[model samples]
Target chain A: MASPRPRTYAEAREVSSSNSELGWWVFMRISGLLLVFLVFGHLWTNNIVIDPATIDYDYVASRLAQPGVRIYDTFLLFFAMLHGVNGLRYSIEDYTKRPGRRFWYKILLYTVSAIIFVLGTMTLWAFTYQEMGDAVRAIGATQ
Target chain B: MYRGREGQWAFLLHRVSGVAIALFLLLHVLDISLVMFGPDGPFDAFLAFYHNWPFRIGLLMVIAGVVYHALNGLRIILMDFTTWGVRYQRQLWYGVLGLTTAIGVPVLWIVVPQIVGGI
Candidate 1:
């Protein structure tokens, strides 16, 4: 079984076999604090300020077109992905019995998370959402 | 170890919610990234499929998970950082649950009708 998580910095230092593990313990608390606001703001805007059912391509395109939204979402994407992926790693370590299974599970998890992060970043930055929205609308107009 | 007490239950819920949210985050990112495929892409169709009531309910569950996880996360932070934290950990957990429900009630009030209307 995986060892118990540290309850304090002192305990962490005592129990942590390596600096990297200590760093992650610190990272989880720091990132978790930030994500509280980042995620709550995201949910409030997407779900409360507007009906999620009404959200579609045009809505997302218009939102993403704004520079502020892009920047905000970029931060959200990075922090949420890192915090979440690390949390999953903790779970994998706790639940998986076989060392080989644990290693492969983490490998698969990291691979998929990396791909999604790249995809999300590209979605935010690779093309101008305004132009993409207009281009799609233009196609619809003619057809 | 917290044994079979509230602290243990809090730890269990935190892990379950963390795993659920992480898995959902992966899928959520993938679907939102579909917007990169432009208007002609499957983004709209995929979103429409999610707009179904069942998925809408699932989204509610996600929101609940996010709320509880986020609040309890703060509780964990407090328990780690402050001298008074360990002393008050159990009381703090009760606070987390109370606040999660308080926040969730308003959220459900606002979102539930939208889901119902779409049906």
Candidate 2:
């Protein structure tokens, strides 16, 4: 027999805990709260405080050069990705009723999420502004 | 139970906002990653294009989505953890609406003029 649907959010939470959905539920709540602060702060800094017209390469490079900014951005990246991926996973499960299709869809979702997360992290930390500047200068010298 | 019209709207808004932000995050990640391509990269070019009027409108929507999602998410947490929260969920929902509007109005006031003024 199919399991009965949860009648309330509380019931849903209980069922989720018994199953494996509890972790994701808790994560969504926590990450959602954090993203509120992180994302809004980010918007305030980039879009409000700084002149959007002035946000060129130098501005971006200088902003990311700070270690504190990097750490804050890394945390934002990680939490946002995980929260979004899990939310999408839930949506996939809800939409895809068939077991086999659901399995494949989740696999694809996870793979893409992982790739995006890795790429974002690398972009945030793999290179310094000085390194990028030197590379640009070297390219210009080669011409 | 979702309980009322406001509760139902909150639920819907939360999901819709979550999905919208997720899609935005995908593009955001890709755009930021362009910085890795070096100083002479297409990143600045992309940002220039992204700063145009149309994209700014799109970003306004994103800000709206984030505001709703964040406030409603906090309401959900409050309901989950507090003793009398479930009993007062409807009130909390109203409070969330009030708070979102309070924050969103000033945000638009500050951001829209900047965008319309060209960047």
Candidate 3:
């Protein structure tokens, strides 16, 4: 074998990941900032824009009937839920130390979070103005 | 003194409060989405149940959760950008806490009594 060539053919070494914790941290900061606007806008409209007393089925029906409101509400649900879950995930990760136990704990955490996320989304989709109206009529019928 | 740093505390509170608020968001959205079914039906029933005292306070807690989550979140972002070193951390957390209280007071003023009165 010719003595190690000037252009040595060395095996490439893969670098390990660093700053994983820092990356999550940056995410929290960015997500938190966006939440200020989304969350506040949601409250201003729901609680402040219209009086809560006026918030009957018809009121919400009209709100969801609008494309803009629907989109906005969908966004609020999507981002806030995601942001919240990620934050919680970080919490569980930080606190649970043992590798095997931590793995199980994370699985549990994700399962619960996923359930809530699914149910919440389904609830949003089930929004039905006509259904609300009929349900109102049925309630009145009983009286 | 070895006080927990500001950015770290803010991070902690933001996480805790965010979870609380997020849970509330799920429930609140579920509650509001009921109106899509119209005002007169199960929607009213769903809301009417919360007219009691305990539920009202519970709702207020939700509001508090929102205040804590949002304000602390803002602090985290600011500290992320600015050079808020360890020494200044506790002060920053206190600052956020004050801001949260300031914002929360008015919300309580409006939301609490209404819930208490079964609104």
Candidate 4:
């Protein structure tokens, strides 16, 4: 079984076993700090400022049309995805007893997460939401 | 590892909340990405489905998890970095729980009514 999580900075450095592991240990702390703000802001805007029930395609589209929202979401997406994916990896290591199962589970997790990450990035940057709505409207009229 | 105690409970809750939030984050990204399919796509339909009372309740739980996880995560950070952090770890945990509940009440007050009215 893997060693217990280190409780102190010195213990973390000594018990890390490798530079990459130490790096991840540090990364978790840094990312977690940033996510507190990012996630709370996201939740406040989406869930509290407006009634979530009224959020539709147009609502999201209009929001994404702003450059500021795009930038904010990009940071939120990057940090949250990396932090969350790594957290899941830690859980897999903790719970998955069999080595074979653990290996396959991580592979599957990374692959799916990578694809989803790409899709999310594309959604943020690939097309203008305003044009997307207009294009759909034009297509509907033509039909 | 720490066995049964307040610290242990704190650790257990942190892990459970972390894992739960991580899974939700993955699904959240995937669903939100549906917007790429354009305005006429299944984005609204999928959102409508989730806006149902059951899913709204689930979303509330996710929010709860996030609040707890975030506060406890700060506790963990403190324990790792500061000298007094470990000495007062138990009290820090109580603070975490207290703060989570403090934030949770207002959140529920805002969300519960929305859920009820949506139904």
User: Can you give the DockQ of every candidate in the order shown?
Assistant: 0.71, 0.56, 0.30, 0.73
**CA lDDT of each candidate?**
0.91, 0.82, 0.64, 0.90
* Tens digits of lDDT, candidate 4, B1-119: 44678888998898888888988988998988888779789999999998899988988988899999999999999999988998899999999999999999998999999999998
How much is the lDDT of residue A77 in candidate 1? 96
Per-residue CA lDDT of candidate 3, range B1-119, in tens? 43655555666666667667766765775675555445544787887665556766776677677877787666545544555533465776787788888888887777766655653
In candidate 2, what are the lDDT values of residues A65-110, reduced to their tens digit?
Answer: 8999999999999999989988888778777889999999999878
Report fnat in order of the candidates: 0.80, 0.63, 0.54, 0.73
Worst 10 residues of 4 chain A by lDDT: A129-138
The most accurate candidate by TM-score is 4
Chain B: TM-scores of all predictions: 0.96, 0.92, 0.76, 0.96
Write the residue-wise lDDT of candidate 3 on A1-143 in tens digits.
Answer: 12321111121011213456445455666667777898888777876555465466556666777878777777777777777767767667667788898788778867866766665565456645666567668877899
Window of ten residues with lowest summed lDDT in model 3 chain A:
A5-14
Q: Write the per-residue lDDT of candidate 2 for residues B29-105, one digit (tens) a residue.
A: 98888887677889999998888889878878887988888888888888877777778989999998899899888
Q: Give the lDDT of residue B51 in candidate 3.
A: 54
Model 3 CA RMSD to the hidden true structure, in angstroms: 9.4
Cα misplacement distance, residue A94 of candidate 1 (Å): 0.5
Position A131, candidate 3: lDDT: 63
Listed per model in order, the count of residue pairs whose N, CA or C atoms clash below 3 Å is: 0, 0, 5, 0
lDDT of 4 by residue, A11-115 (tens): 999998799989999999999999999999999999999999999988988888899999999999999999999999988988999999999999999999999
Instruction: List candidate 1 stretches off by more than 4 Å.
Output: A1-4, A130-143, B1-3
State TM-scores per candidate: 0.93, 0.87, 0.71, 0.94
Clashing pairs for predicted structure model 3, backbone only: A57-B38, A57-B39, A132-B37, A132-B38, B6-B89
- lDDT tens digits, residue span A1-143, model 1: 45676778989998998999899999999999999999999998999999988899889988988999999999999999999999999888878889999999999999999999999998898888666667768787899
